[model samples]
Target chain A: EYPHVLLAHGGGGRLMHQLIDAIASTFASAELARRHDGAALRIGDMRLAFTTDAFVVQPLFFPGGDIGKLAVCGTVNDLAMCGARPLYLSVSFILEEGLSMETLGRVVASMQAAAHEAGVEIVTGDTKVVDRGKGDGIFISTAGIGVIEHDRPIGPEAVRPGDAVLLSGDIGRHGIAIMAVREGLAFETEITSDCAPLAAPVLKLLEAGVAVHCLRDLTRGGLAAALVEIAQTAGLHIQLDEAAIPVRPEVQSACELLGIDPLYVANEGRFVAFVPEAEAERALSILQTEPVSADARVIGHVTADGPAGLVTLRTAIGTTRVLDLLSGEQLPRIC
Target chain B: EYPHVLLAHGGGGRLMHQLIDAIASTFASAELARRHDGAALRIGDMRLAFTTDAFVVQPLFFPGGDIGKLAVCGTVNDLAMCGARPLYLSVSFILEEGLSMETLGRVVASMQAAAHEAGVEIVTGDTKVVDRGKGDGIFISTAGIGVIEHDRPIGPEAVRPGDAVLLSGDIGRHGIAIMAVREGLAFETEITSDCAPLAAPVLKLLEAGVAVHCLRDLTRGGLAAALVEIAQTAGLHIQLDEAAIPVRPEVQSACELLGIDPLYVANEGRFVAFVPEAEAERALSILQTEPVSADARVIGHVTADGPAGLVTLRTAIGTTRVLDLLSGEQLPRIC
Candidate 1:
């Protein structure tokens, strides 16, 4: 009975799921109904991954990256999560009138650099301008198409009870970096955004013959959101060791000062990979070869035989607490 | 020498061209620097076309169609213009926080119907909500991927001096329709938008063996914009017969009342196709068989052998005038 869209509906949590479900119910195909990071399609014996993301972060420029880099990396990572080799991207820019041409040049340059580093091409693009008051400076929407070379069935459904959940690098840095700049909150140490492309590392793991079941990038609602979504979609229980999850000290202090949980803070360059318990070490080793994922480690494991849809964290104080989707609005438009 | 973006920069005219050129010049690949309707890519022996467009039309709902319908048809038309069979699309919605759920539902339902008619699947999508005052009601961006079944190399470069220019249907209805609602100008007769899926009729022509050298949809700057862009890109001269171009009486009246030329007005379902003079009759016959293109006619021809990069229109009074890109913005966000 929601009459107006709440900011929480776009927070990548329970309300977002409900909104998607409501909209997708009208689509005729079952593929549209499935909630996957990206859609996989078969074209003349070739498997392709298609994904789209809109970047509307308030401050166009952040500590480490800008909207352009995030626009490319976000869609590229979504395709990577589908076990695809990211190849081509189409970028569309919606700019407000009176935006500086110099600013546009810097953003586009950042996109080119990011695309080059990820080994993907910026093939086609579109541009539109809105009146100054009607829009934030600029919003970028990128749609990516990739070739799926890995034969593994990658999705939430592939996750099993004995799968070990591995995370690539640290979390919470991106959200904190943006928040500090937006709110003018100063910390003892400067915090930088961890916004780097992870396609190379992901493809490396798949090429090395790791049987990865599912992969989800920690964005929007962050690590907790990703885990909760996976648990719900796979109908399984996920148990996490809170001490193992990496959070930078500066980011931790910033989140504490803002009264926000580090686990719910966004990260642009981090992802969670669910691999079979036996191959977890091999996957971690391959991921560690890439600087972007050098801190890869197993942080949790699937721990149920039936449909439980539960996620719990084992805290440092020797107590268990349930982790669910953040129900209220938090850090809107973080990504 | 441009320092800030202007509304004219998004007017699908000279300023817009300069903006794209400035941004694309930094790309490492030449493919990105070239401005085409879509980028053609070869993937392991299969040829595909990828293109994206963002719809920011005001008044969300119009006379004949809504924003959702435009979101689907616009991308489908872009692929068809590349001589590709429209196959799949990824839709992304940027909604304002206060947008009504009922409105969103109707828009999505319209998109579903449009996608169904175009024989394209809404495979993947992303949605983000902005704070209430920061955004217009809704903005939809769609990216489409299609397979190239036609063996002919279709582009402005393929246009020859002896090629005939054919328009699929009437023009100016879409723009006038939106203007009618926004400006509250009422005519004696109602003007409905010609927004429709052009893929079926386009594919029929290709299947019937008509050798189309170039195709461009009449959007934004409308027929004049599409023709001017092609002429400049191909370095050729284009000649048009104003009397032969189809414009409904009501649309003509509306355009006159608004002091706008129908040729420079936007259209959603109309496209201009170029084919050799020898095959023009057969192509027209095949196109006319489809209800969507029943009024198809040859409106002009590629005239000068030299690359003049000029377009001339022969008025009904036997006077000729130069047709140039609209210098200033006429209608903003009319797409």
Candidate 2:
């Protein structure tokens, strides 16, 4: 057992998963047990999705988005991943005593704009200030509630054999962008974070009656962690074509230079959707209608002819390698 | 406008109110404009109440309660003040790196026990860890969703002239208890925080058909801040009998020693119910049924004769004084 919480415990890898499991086991609710991006609930004939996230990014402001924008979009995308139309959000801010009002105003303004873009209302909130040294500039915790319009159960539990895994867009830009700014690395081309709301495209896919089995966002541990988690939870094997996964040239170069794998880097606005092979083309078309998912591609498929919970990737060089969760975090506080 | 956010901005006084107003104006939602403890929402034939709070109590653990218990009880009570039955909660944690796993385990256990006592389920959660010096040991933010069963329009706006204000139990213990622990003050009798879930007593009042106009919990800035905010929101006058306001001898002594007024000190398990003068006795009896509020008493009444947005208190020496929100915080991180 771990004696203390290391930075890796919140790094969105194996350690983070273990920490989450330990805390979740104590509560022991069925909704929590499902372990989806959010908890789906039924209250008086209404189906709602509830989720919460804490954003503790170090720099506060990054290449493409600030912490406020990231906070709103992160929770909104989690609800959207549950195939729910995002509705209301509650934001609670823990600010350090010495934070400038101008900085706070800028963050609040960014949040308002992001909420407007996502069509969600900021309904209620709270604020607490810690002493100057006790807290960073600001840490925002947002909990969102959304309504699920479709009747399908959307989560890892619904994944089945012979399902296609479609990625929404390119990966690794978000983590690289933050790292570049933090480390003062001047890349030939600026790598901006791909942080945007995915609710519109997700809702569009649902409106077109796409048979979506599951959806998972590539957040902290990126594409690999999401796939590994889904494979384990569904007790299925996943096969991926490495060439089909999109990583921007700048991001790929930065990863190579820093000895980081693009597959395990974090993304703010990318997700993978599981659907039947027959509906893959239609789902991709629908997702492409939105700018956020214009680069959507089918990267993998689920299968039952292998060991359960195994994920194998076929490299461009025609070599197969198993993908597993990293014991330590590649990046800390990317979100 | 302030140049930087001060500790007083989160002290639940005038500065806090101003900061909240500024943020709320940017969101511009009617539910948020009400400035209630929680926002009451209507979703598909369901009347829901949503609220969020962040707990940054120093020392982690204090007499009679800890941050974990406070986090659960605070959100639950916010929902209860909305006249709703809290059904589900979303908890998010921000941990500082290097915190002992044992401390986290203890906090999680306390949260579970408190949730069980409050009859609410922790349906969803998230966690993030900051560098050791960037954050306090732990900060917990909880957002609760509760269902309102009654149809009465309850809030400061519903408060009317001739309404009676009934307080639940004594005040000043919670803030004093934390101060005692932090300052290493040893009193003749230990002063423990009155931090407890108030949903049971609140639900009892509603179930008993009490004509409750409004409910306000005595939290951060204590009774004075709650009264002033209510008076200003209702645009009415409130008169209180200071002698009738219960303050235990130990808490009173501690407050005096610290040069703090008991009326401005915070309480965790206390609240005030605004009802018609005719139903005051019945409401008191109903509140007394629950052990959390056994010391319920009628302490004040609403009036229209004085200046609008005014709160007056009658002292034991037959002198009247006006209660106003403090310009600065008396105690930072008391809750």
Candidate 3:
């Protein structure tokens, strides 16, 4: 552990994992022990998923989404990953003094629009302001409550060997989008973030009876981090086909130009689902019907042949390499 | 209405009220329209209360409580105000890069202790780190969900004429304690913050069949703001006896020295309960049984006469004066 908190501690990588583990160990509870994107608890006869996320993305706004939209969508997606229908959200803001009211209005409006799109209501909230330099422009923390309609316990524990791994869409765009704007990188075709709510598609899959064993959204640490976490938690091995994973050309180029791996780049709207191999085609088709996941495809499958808690990636050049968690963040504050 | 967001907008005074109203109008929902400290929600046959609060109190460590304890107790108290037994909380942290790891550990330990004392589980959480100088040492945002066992429909709308207003304990200690530490004020006897979880006392009142009509914690804008907001919402006038309201001598002296009103000072643990006039003594006794509310007393009563949405205070010298919300915050970031 580092003696002082560093930006990497929140990068959703290995450092972030260590930090969360330390915190989780201190606040150990049955629900928190699950270590999923959200905590699923049974309240009487109803099962609810509760989750929280704090957005400290710099610039506040990027090409496709602003901090407001990201805040809402991020929490909603966490609930969605738990196979829950997000119903209500509590939004809290820590605003810096001297921030433009116009900017605040725009962010609030963006939040409203995002909430409406995600079919979730912003029910409760709190606002606190800090001195000008003590805070960035704004930081939005959102907590979401959602209802799990199905009986399937969707999490890493439910993951089984031979389960098909499906990627919802292209990755790396969101990170590239944020990095391009933050680093003043100009590209012929601007790469907008693929930041969209995933509840609709997830609900359709569940409603259509897709036996989703596990679901994880690719966020701060992108596809690699999500896969590594699931593998470690499930005590299983996952094999990924790099050729099958979708990545936009512009985003790939952006990653290459910045000496970053596309697999390590973040994605706000992308998620991977694990289902029985027999149901992979049906799940893919159901996901493809939704515009957000139109690029959905089967990327790989779980296997028991390797050591547990290992993830291997088959490169495009017919080489297999172990995919490991990055120690630090390639781009900080790219939320 | 200001072009830029001033600290007053988050001060929990008139400006904060206006800012909240504007934001609320944009994110209008049935739960939000109620405007209670927490939103009471119905999920299937179960009724739940959900609320969020962000703690940006400077000088993270105060005389009696730290920001970590304050964060947990604040959200728990909000749910208590909704007449709910807080069950779970989601803790999110926005950390500034380069903050000492020891400080983070101490804060987390405090949060765990506070959560344990409040009888709530920290189920889920998120952490984000910003660059040094971009944020204060740390800002904690907590969202809590609690179960509402009773069907009393407690809120301002449930208040009736001739309702007795009860104060749990001394006011102004929390705010003054923070101010003393932040401003380096030397008081002979230190004023420790009255920051503790109020759920136990409130639950006791409800269980004892006190016919509680409304409950509200005195936080940022303190007793004055809570009373005014409740009065305006219930469309009734309230009259308070100044001599009956409890205020510690040290707290009063500090407020006087700082030229701040005790009525407008924040208290983290204290709350006001509105019950039927006939049950005033019973409710006070029930509250006093608990150590947190040992100083419970009748401070005022709701009246239908005179003007609606007015709060009048009767001084010890037989003079009545109107208590209104402060236009700006006397102390910002005091929460």
For residues A228-256, write the lDDT of model 1, one tens digit per residue.
88998899999999999999888888888
Q: Distance from true position, residue B62, model 2, in Å?
A: 0.9
Model 1 chain A scores worst on lDDT over the 10 consecutive residues at A27-36
The DockQ for candidate 3, computed on C-alphas, is 0.91
Question: Each candidate's TM vs. the true structure?
Answer: 0.98, 0.99, 0.99
Q: What does candidate 1's lDDT look like per residue over B1-335, in tens digits?
A: 87898888888887888788877777655566446789889888889999999998998999999999999999999999888999999999899998999999999999999999999999999999999878898988999999998678888888888899999988999999999999998888888899999988889989988989999989889999999988988888999999999999998888888899999999999999999999999999999999989999999999776447888899999999889988655788897
List the candidate 1 regions with Cα displacement exceeding 4 Å.
Answer: A305-307
Number of backbone collisions per candidate: 0, 0, 0
CAPRI tier of model 1: high
Sort order, lDDT high to low? 2, 3, 1
Local accuracy of candidate 3 as per-residue lDDT tens digits, A155-212: 9999999999999998999999999998899999989999899999999999999899
Q: Which ten residues in a row have the lowest lDDT in candidate 3 chain B?
A: B28-37
Looking only at chain A, give the TM-score of model 2 against the true structure. 0.99
